[model samples]
Structure formats: C-alpha cells, structure tokens
Target: MNYRTNPKNGDKISQLGYGCMRFPSSATAGVSDIAEVKRLIKTAFDGGVNYFDTAFVYGDSEKVLGEVLEDLGIRDKILLSTKMPQFSCKSGADFETYFKKQLAALRVDYVDYLFIHNVSEKKRWDELKSWGILDWIQEKLDKGQAKNVGFSCHGSTSEFKAILDDHDWDFIMLQYNYLDENWQVGREGLKYAADKGVPVFIMEPVRGGLLADKLPPKAKTAFDNLPTKRSYASNAIRWVLDQPEVTMVLSGMSAFEQVTDNLTTASEINAGGLTDNERSAYVAAAAAIREFMDVYCTACGYCLPCPKGVSIPDCFYYYNLSFIDDMASVKRNFAGFVGNGNISACVGCKACERHCPQSISIAEKIAAARTRFGL
Candidate 1:
C-alpha cells in the first residue's frame, strides 16, 4: 500500500486508513458478528493498512477494533486513532473519566493519535478551551496516554483557519471528496494545514457512499468513457489522492468486499497520480452528480447553532440522497445520524438561512425534507 510520512514525527501512515464507524451489523442490531468483523479487519491489516480510526461515540467501535487487533496479535503493527467526545464534557474531569473508560474499552495503554471529536465551530472550540481541553491534551501527552493530538472538523473555512492557527496540532481530519472540493474546510483548508506543516487525513472521500453507488446516468457515462477500467469508488478515491496535501484517506468499509476493493485501489494509486484525462473525467462526473442533487448543502456546519437545534445540512443531504437512492436507507441514516436534530425540529426560525452561503431557503428545504422522509 502507498504510505505517507507524518510531517511531525515521520511515522508512515497508510494511504488507506480504516475507519471503524460503520462496521457491518453493528449499528442496526446493536450487536456485531465479532468473527466477521475480525476477518474484515485482518484482511485490511494484512493488506498493509496501518492506520485504524475510531471514536468513543462510534458505538463499540473501539472495543471491536481492540478485540480484533489483540486477537490477531497485531496491535503493534498498526497506528490506532480515536477521539474524545468533546460534546459530552461538562467539566475538565469528564475528559479523564471518559478517556480512562475508552482506554479500558480498547485495552490499549496509549492511543497513537487522539482528536477532539467533531470540533465544528469556533464557539464549540472556545467552550472546549474554556473547559481546559488543551491542558487535558497536554496531560495525556505528558503521561504517555496519547502519542499525538489533533482534531476533526466540520466547520466553516474561517473557523478551520482559526483552529489551525491556534494550536500546534499533529494532524487534522476533514470531510473531503470530489463533490466537496469547495465545501467546508475544503481544498483551501487542506492546503492551509499543509502550508503550516500539518498532515491531513481525509474522511468521507465518497461523500458517505453517495459517489460510489447509484450514480446518475450522466456521471456513470462520464466514468465509463475513461480509457482505463476502474470502479466509481476507485475514481472517487484516486481523485482525493491526487491532492498532494492529503496524508491519508479513511474509508469506512462495511463489508469484506469493500475492504478488498479499497485495498486494491489504495495500493494502485499514489498522490498526484491522476492524468489530465482522468482529471477531466472526474470533473464531468462531479458535474453530473451535482445535477442529481436537489439541495446544494455540502453538510458543512456553518449554518449550525440553530436555536431550534435543527440539523439543516444533514437533513438536506439525506433528503437529496432519498431522491436518487433507497428511501429506507435514507430514513435509517436520518434517524441514526441526525438524532434529536431531525428536520421536524425546525421552528421556522430563519437563523440558519441567514448564515447559509448557498442561499438555500433553510425552512422551506427542511419542510420539504420532513415531508419527503415522512418524519
């Protein structure tokens, strides 16, 4: 597999970092087939994936990863990364309490990379700082509880810049894809962090599987015309790898087939490997995908902090997906991911609309999404 060096300490991170959030059968039944999960992870590790990312809120993901790694006796063969649930913190002590629990769950003495989970806005970061998050991180680093510290963000470009400038972060993770090159902390943020000598790990390279499956006819046609044969998913991943600043691309593989396919793609592609024709094909495919989307929301959290707590962008994302994909899966994700911030919670307040850069009618779209999802 292709590997990139961590700019800070020169650790070799695989281009295909395994994301542990969507392990098969884990979310729907609240139970995982441990044997199957272990096989999938072992396949990935044997294929040279050294980075495994999970989080406290990912519902037993850390435990499953720990079990598989230990059972395989390859715990030291990979770099384990997980996040602190910043939203659950009420005091500085909560950090230690939750972290110790995570360590216990994972059965690991130290996390190779630890992040502040979902730091999506400046206000949230400010509150985390006030709650002594920096000190908590330093404490972990000092005591060897965490080897490196960073954050995953879904905030505006300005907020991302502010956070990147504020700290000497070891790395940063962002939602990046061909469809979201100009979206929240997009290519600009990727370059900004790289300029400051920070490595970037990308999540959602396929926009949560949208770019990989159920492609619009035109998009499929564009990819079909490519001289070289590749799956839509491979094109999506390679497109992200074309950007030299991306240090690793995380794929939350849910099945063994997915693991194998992604490993092959990762092994074949390298940074700046896309040719001019391949690049044009990607642009055409992206245009076709955009044509199918009903809303322009990129799921950036800029229009967040809605007084009514409506998950505006998330609702729009699933709503748009429902038109092009299976309604049942859309409903499941809306319920699973959106939670209490479902579109029905919108109070018709235009607070989010005023902040939206896309000029979308926030209330109108939420109402439409609510009706479409039957929420």
Candidate 2:
C-alpha cells in the first residue's frame, strides 16, 4: 500500500486507512459478522494496509477488531487508531474510565494513535478543557499509552480552525471527499493544516459510500464514458488522493472486493497523480451530482445569519446526502446540529430566501431536512 510520512512523528501511515465503523452487520443489531470481519481484515493485512481506525462509539467494533487482529497475530503490524468519546466526559475521572475501556476492548495496552472523537463545537472543546481533558491527554502521551494524539472534527470551518490551533496535535482527522471538497475543513483547511506541519487523515473520503456506489445516472455515465475505466469507488477515492495535503484517506471496507479494490488504488495513486482525463471525469461527475440535488444551493454563505439560526447550506448538504446514504447513518450524523443548525430551528420567515442566489424555497427545504433527519 502507498504510505505517507506523519509530519509530527515520522510514522509511515497507509494512504488507505481502514475505518471500522461500517463493518458488515450480522442478524443481531449492534453486532457485526465477526467471521466476515476477520476475512476482510486478513485480506487487507495481507495486502499491506497497516493503518486501522475504530472508535468508542462504533458498537462492539473495538472488541471485534481486537479479536481479529489478535487471532491473526498482527496487532503490532498496523498503526491502530481508536477515538475517545470526549463529549460524554463530564468529570476529570471520566477520561481514564473511557480510555481504559477502549484499550481493554481493543486488547491493546496502548494505541498507535488516539483521537478526541468528533469535536463539533468550540464550546465542547472548551468544556473538555474545563473538565481537565488536556491533562488527561498529556498523561496518556507521557505514560506511553497513546503514541500520537489528536482529534476528529465534524464542526464548521471556523470551529475546525479554532480547535486545530488550540492543540499541538500529532495528527488530525477531517471529513473530506471529492463531493465534500468545500465542506468542513475542505481543501483550504487541509492546506491550513499542512502549513502548520500537521498531518491530515481524511474520513468520509467517499461521502459515506455515496460518491462510491450511489452516484446519479448522469454522474455514473460521465465516469463510465471516460477513456480509462474505473469503478465509481476508484474515481472518488483517487480524487481525494490527488491533493498532497491529504496524509491519508480512510475507507470503511466491509466486503472482500472493497479491500482488494482499495488496495490496488492505494498502491498506484499518489499525490497529484491523477491524469488529465481522470481530472476531467471528476469535474463532469461532480457537476452531475450537484445537478441531482433537490435544491440548487451551492453552499455559498449568501443565505447565512438566518433569523432562526438555521444552517441553510449545512441543512441542504445533509439533505442532498439523504438521497444517497443510508437513512440511519444520515440521521445519526445529522443529530449533531440538533439545537443549533437543525432545520427545526427555521421559522420560515423568508429571511434567508430573500438573499438566496438560486431562489430556492428555503422554508420548504428546511422542513424537509427537519423531517428527513428525524428532528
């Protein structure tokens, strides 16, 4: 697999890191198909994928991943990363309690990389600091419990910048993909991180499998008509790898075919390695994807500062994502904006609609977002 050097510590991380959140589910809820999970991880391990990421919030995946790596005798062969649910931490002692639980579940005394999971607001980071999370993190590093420390952000660009600057992180993770190039940190945030010598690990590189498998017919045709053939997954993945600022792209591979396909692309694609035709195909496909959205909202801040605090662009972003991703996962992630930006906050005053360049029915779409995301 292709590897990139971590700017903070010089560790060689696989360009294609394994995301354990989407492990194939079994008949029982919250339980993954362990046997199939083993096969998939084994295939990836054999194919030279060394970076494995899981999280405390991903149900039973830590234990399952721990079992798979232990049985295969490859625990030490990979760069293991698991997230700590820092939002739930209220007291100083809660930090160690959660960290130990994750370590025990993963069957590892220490993780190669440890992240503060899903920081979505500056207030949340501030609360964690008040609760002594910084001291706890330093303890983990000093005691050799976590080799590298950082955070995975699901907040706005401004929030991302604030949190990134607040810590001397060994690495940071962001949700990035071809379709999501302007969301969250986007390309500019990646560049910002690079400027400070921070290594960036990308999550949602395929937009929750939307860009990979659920492309609109027009976008699919655009990719299929390319002179060089590639899967829907390959085109989206390679596009993210095209930027040198991206240190790694994490793929949650649930199938054997996915493992092999991702391995092939990881081994071949490098920074700025996409050819002219592939680049053209990306533009064509992106335009088609945008054309399929319910609203023509280009996520320009034109409709910002809504009277009711509605995140117009964000609401529509996830609203468009609803057409592609699974409803369950969409709702869960969309829950982050519950009180602040969730479309339920909209008062339908036409305040934002007046400034919309696309003249979209802002109230109507916000209502749809509210219902679609189960707000």
Candidate 3:
C-alpha cells in the first residue's frame, strides 16, 4: 500500500485509513459488534492498513475500538485517531472531562491524532476560544496526551482558509471527492494546505456512498467499458488516491464484504495510477452525473426569506434522493424529507431562483419533486 509521510513527525501513514464508523451492528442495532469489529480490524492490519479513525459520536465507536484493541493485543501496532466533541461541552472544564472519558473508552494512554470535531464556521471558532479551546489543547500536547492536534472541517474554502491561517496545526482533515472538489472546502483549500506542507486527510471520498451507487446510465456505461475489473466504489477511491497532496483517504466500510473490497482496492492503489484515457472516462462520467441534477441552488442560502418555513437546499437534497435509478433505501429518506416540508409552500416566488448561482428553476424542481414522490 502507498504511504505518505506525516508532515510533523515523518511517520509513514497508510494512504487508506480505516474509519470505524461502519462496523457491523450488534444487538443494540447501531452499536458495533465487538467480535466482528475485531475481526475486521485484524483483517485490515493483515492487509497493511495501520491507520484507524474513530470518533465519540460514531455510535459507541471508541468503546468498540478500545475493546477490540485490548482483546486482540494489537493496539500498539495501529495508529489510533479520535475526535473531541466540543459541541457537547458547555464549559472549558468539560473538555478535560470528555478527554479523560474518551481515553478510558479507547483504553489508550495517548492518541496519535486528535481533532476538534467538525468546526465549520466562524461562530464555532468564537465558541472554541470563549471556552479556552486552544489552551486546553496545548496542555494535552505538552503533557503528551495527544501526539498531534488537528481538525476535521465541512465548511467553505474561505472559512477553511481562515482556520488554516489561524493555527499552526499538525495536520488537517476535510471532506473531498470528485464531486466535492469544487464544493465544500474545494480544490483550492486542498492545494493551499499541501503548499503549506501540511498533510491532508480526506473524508467522504465516496460522497456518503452516492458515487459508489446511483451512477447515471451514461456514467454506468463509462464504467462498463473499462478494461480493469473494479466496482464504482473503487473507482471513486482511486480518483482520491491519485492526488499527491492527500495523505490518507478515510473509507467508512460497513460490512465484511465492503471491508474486504476496500482493503484490496487500497493496497493496489498508487499515485498517478489512472491513465489518460481512464482519466477522461472518469471525468466524462462525472459530467453525466451532474446533468441529472434538477436544481442548481448550490445551498448558498442567498434566498432564505421564505414566506413559508421551507428549507430550499435541504428540499433539493432530498428531492435528488428520489430520482435515484433504484430507490431501495433512499426512498425512505426521501419520504421523511417531504414530511418535513412540502413543495406547495413555495408560493411560486421568483425571489429564490433570482439569487441562485446555478440559475436552477427552483419552483419547477420543487413541483417536480412533489408530483414524482406523490407528496
């Protein structure tokens, strides 16, 4: 497997990091199955994957990871990364409370990588400081409780730049995919971090399984003509790994089959792996997927003064879910989305569409969604 040097310590981190959020469910129906989770961990290690990522909010992931590591006696062999839930804390003292709890949950004395979970806006930055966030973190680093300090962001490029410029971070993580290269924290942010000599870790490389499935008919045809045998999921993964700046790409694999498939793909992937023809095919496929979009709102919130309590961007997101070639599980999410807001409330006002960057026919898209979903 390809490995990249951690900018701070020069440690060789695997390109494919295992995200433990997808571990098999236990009797709690959402909690991870300890035995199966351990097996998956062992399998990943055997396949040359050494970076494991988990978080406090990922459905008891820390506890499961701790149990599995202790049971298997391989905790030292793997690099453990987890996050602090700053949102759950009301005061600066609460930071230490949660940190101690997480250490016990993971049964680890120190974390190799620890991040302030999901800082997406300036408001969160204000909150972090008001609560002495940096001071508490510096204490952990000085005390050797955390090997590195980092953050995972789901904000815009401008906001991300502000964060990057504001701190002397060890590393930074962001959501990046072929589709999101120009979306949240786009290509500009990716390159900026790389230029600053910061190793970037990528999350949502598959766009939350959207690219893995729901390929447009034209896009599916592109994959079908490919000479190499691989799934749509691996294609998306390979695209991320092709970038030289990305230190590690995190994949949330849910089942044993998924875990096995991802491990195989990760070990086989290399930088500059895709040929010119294959690169063109993937780009063409992405364009075809974009054509299926009914609206171009961009979720910028420019037109938010709705007379009715309708969330336009969320409405569009759910609307897109219903148009998938095979509904399967997405249909349920679509149904729930409409139950929250109806298209009938749009009032046919041109105000929203006027400010839309993509110039999408907002009223038309909502009307279509209403009729199509039988809402």
Candidate 4:
C-alpha cells in the first residue's frame, strides 16, 4: 500500500487505513464474529495496512479490535487509533473516566493516536475546555498515554475551522467523498488544514457505502458509462485520494472482498491520477446524487437502536430509494423495514439527530416514511 507521512511525527501511515467499526456481523449474533473479524483484519494487514481506527461508542469495536490485534501479535506493528467519546463527558473526571475505560477496552496502556471523539462545533470544544480538555491531552502526551492527538469533524466549515485554528492539532479526520466535496467541512476546510500543515485523514470516503449501492439512475449511468468500469466505491475512493490535500482514507471494510478492493485502489490510484473522463464522470454523478437525494443521510448507524428499536438508517435508505427506483422494487425490499408497524416505532424523539454526523431530521424523515410507505 502507498504511505503518507504524518506531519507531526514523520510516521509512514498507510494510505488506506482500516476503520474497525463495520466488521462483518455474524448472521446469528449480529455482532462481528471473532474468527471472521480476525481473518478480515489479517488480510488487510498482510496487504500492507498499518493503521486501524476504532472508537469507544462503536459497540464492542474496541474490544473486538483489541482481541484481533493481540491474537495476531501485531499490535506493536500497527498504528492504533481510538476516540474519547467526549459527548458523554461532563467534567474533568469524566475525561479520565472514559480514557481509562477506552484503554481497558483496547487492552493497551497507550494508544498511537487519540481523539476527542466527535467535536463538531466550537461550542462543544468550549465546553470541553471548561472540563479541562487541554490539560488532559497534555497529560496523555507527556505521560506517553497517547502519541498523537486529533479530532474527527462532522460540522459546518466555520465550526471546523474554529477548532482547527484553536490548537496545533497533529491531524484531523473529515468526511470526504464525491458526494460531500462541497458539503460538511468540505474542500475549503481540507485546503485550510493543508495550508496549516495538519494532515487530514478522511472518513466516509464512500458515504457509508451509499455511493456503491444506492446511486440514483442518472448517477449510476454516469459511472456505468465509463470505459474503465470500477465499482462505485472505488471511483468514489479514487476521487478523494486524487486530491493532494488528503493524507489518507479510512475504509470501514466489513468483508474480505472489500479489503482486496480497497487495497487495489490504494496501490494503483495515485494522487492526481484520475483521467479527465473519470473526473468529468465524478462531476456528473455528484450532480445527479444531489438532484435526487431525499434525506441527506450517510447511514452511519450512529443514530441507531432508537429507544424503541426503530431501524433509523434503513428507514431513510428506503425512503430515498422510493424516489429514484421502481416503486414495486423499493416496496419489496423496504417491506422488512417498513410497510408494517416498524416505522411507527419512532416516537418523534430527537435523540438520533444529536449523534447524526449528517444532521438529518431523522424523526421527520421517519414520519415521512410512515405516511408515504407504512401502508
């Protein structure tokens, strides 16, 4: 795999880092099977992926990753990253509380990379300060509990820039895919980070797999017409890697096939390597995506387990699909998510919105699905 230098420490991070959240779920248990996860991780690591990112809130992700890395005896050979779940921190002690828990879950005393979890706005950062955010980070740095510090962004460009300039961060992770080039801490924030010499690691490089699966007809056609014919995921990933400002991309590969696909894209597609036709195709597909997108959701599943077990992401997915695809086909697949008593489970609670990186009005969209498809 290709590598990029971490501006702060000169670490040669793999260009295609593994995001450890979406491990292939077991058909019976719904959580990732330990054996399968180990195999998938081993494949990626053997393929030259040295960076793996996990988070405390990503449902047993830290435990599963720690187990796989330890079992493989490759923990020392990789760059390990995890988050602090700051949204749950209310005081200085809470910081220590969560960090201790994360280290325990990860089965490591120190992390190569640590983050403030999801700092979307300056207001949140300000609150973190009142709770002693800076002092805690410095302690970790001085004591060797963390080697590098950064944050993941999911806010407006203004909020992103505010936090970025507020401190000398080693790096920052942002959502960058073909569909989000001009949205959410878009290219403008990316350029700002590049100018500051803060390496920008990318998340959601394929829009949570939406670019690969649910493209509108026009968007699919635009990509389908290309002579080279790569998967929608590869085309989207290549577009992000083509930008010189991107330091690396974190693909949450759930299966072995995805690991191989990403590895091929990483080794072959270099910066500024996209052909003019491919570039134009990205332009055309992006426009079509925007024109037909109903709810601006990435299906990240952060807004999940709705107090009532309402499947929030699936609701938006089918709701959006109804518009661009055949109604009969949409309804057939959507039958499991809605067209029953499921959509009615959403109790108009706004809890999902708080965690949604895309800031979708989830309850409102769920309501729309109820009215339009919950027959």
- What is the lDDT of every predicted structure here? 0.85, 0.84, 0.80, 0.88
Alpha-carbon TM-score of each model against the true structure: 0.85, 0.81, 0.83, 0.97
* Between candidates 2 and 4, the lDDT winner: 4
Ranking by lDDT: 4, 1, 2, 3
Question: What does candidate 3's lDDT look like per residue over 1-375, in tens digits?
Answer: 668788768989989999887688888856677888878888888888889998887778899899988988888888899988776788999889988999999999999999888776767777888889889989999999998989888778898888888888889999887777788787899999999998899988886566776567787778778888788888889889988888999988777777788888888878787878678878888888787766544453445556675677767766675564555455566556555355567777776766453457877877777777666
Give the alpha carbon lDDT tens digit for every residue of 208-325 in model 2. 5668766777788888988878779988889988889989989988888888999999998999898888887778888888875786454544577787777788778778877866
Best by TM-score: 4
| Candidates in descending TM-score order | 4, 1, 3, 2
What is the lDDT for 319 in model 1? 83
Q: Which ten residues in a row have the lowest lDDT in candidate 4?
A: 336-345
lDDT string, candidate 1, 181-209, tens digits: 98889989999999988999999898767
Clashes of each: 0, 0, 0, 0
Worst lDDT window (10 residues) for model 1?
296-305
Quick one: best lDDT, which candidate? 4
RMSD score of candidate 4 (Å): 1.4
lDDT of 4 by residue, 1-375 (tens): 888888767999899999988887877655878898999999999999999999988888899999989999999999999999898887889988999989998899999999888799999999898888899999999999999999999998999999999998988999989888889999999999998999999999998778987788899899899998788888889999998898899999998889999999998888888999999998999888888678888877878778888888887888888888888788888885454567777789788788887878888888887787745
**Which pairs clash (backbone N, Cα, C closer than 3 Å) in model 2?**
none
